[model samples]
Target: MNTVQEAKRYLDNAREILREKAHKEEGYYLDTKYVKMAGHTAYVGVLVALDGLLGKKGKGRKGVDWYNQQLSGLDKRPLRSFVGAYDTLHLSMSYDGNPLASVAAAGLAEAETIIKWVESRTVEA
Candidate 1:
């Protein structure tokens, strides 16, 4: 598959894992692994999908800038905020010991929004 399709598949699989975790008792806390995995998957998948769609680079600082520029139209700034929030949360989880509670919340919200955004785009395409 192409990068966009691969990324979309990852995000879709992540969403399914997240939903299963969300159904459990203690949910988010009990299924921290799924949450963490989903967060990372969504972050990378969304960035790759965005880069593919916008015809830009697919990683690093330039990739982030490309995403921000492509999503400069939302009223509440959901797209840009989602990307930034997920990136920050990913960094914290991957490097800074534990992921902060607030960052987790932000990442979860961002993940959900990004899935929604991708769905809409898929429908449009």
Candidate 2:
């Protein structure tokens, strides 16, 4: 599939995972391990979305540092939100197991926004 298609797939998959697994249900008990898994899955989707954006720009697949550098040069607001999402969702929640629900929610929202922005810029051939 093309980059835009790939990005949309990742975003859709992420949304499904978040809705079915990551999000906590009211008055329902969720396992910590499952929560952690959900966080990791969500973060992978974010990375895939970034990869799609960069690939569309002919940047090839690169690491997160490259993504950070590109974002820093391209736009400040999304860059800030991307960094925040990386810190809280990728590092704190995915790795450290200390993600505040509100913070994770916000980070996921930011990721969704960034993915949409990237999609808007995609020029399908």
Q: In candidate 2, list every pair of residues with a backbone clash.
A: none
Could you tell me the TM-score of candidate 2?
A: 0.71
What candidate 2 gets wrong by more than 4 Å, as runs, is 1-29, 56-61, 123-125
lDDT string for model 1 (12-84, tens) is: 7756765666344432334566667766776776666555555645655665555566677543465666556
Candidate 1 displacement at residue 105 in angstroms: 4.4
lDDT of model 2 at position 40: 66
All-Cα superposition RMSD per candidate: 4.9, 3.8
**Candidate achieving the largest lDDT:** 2
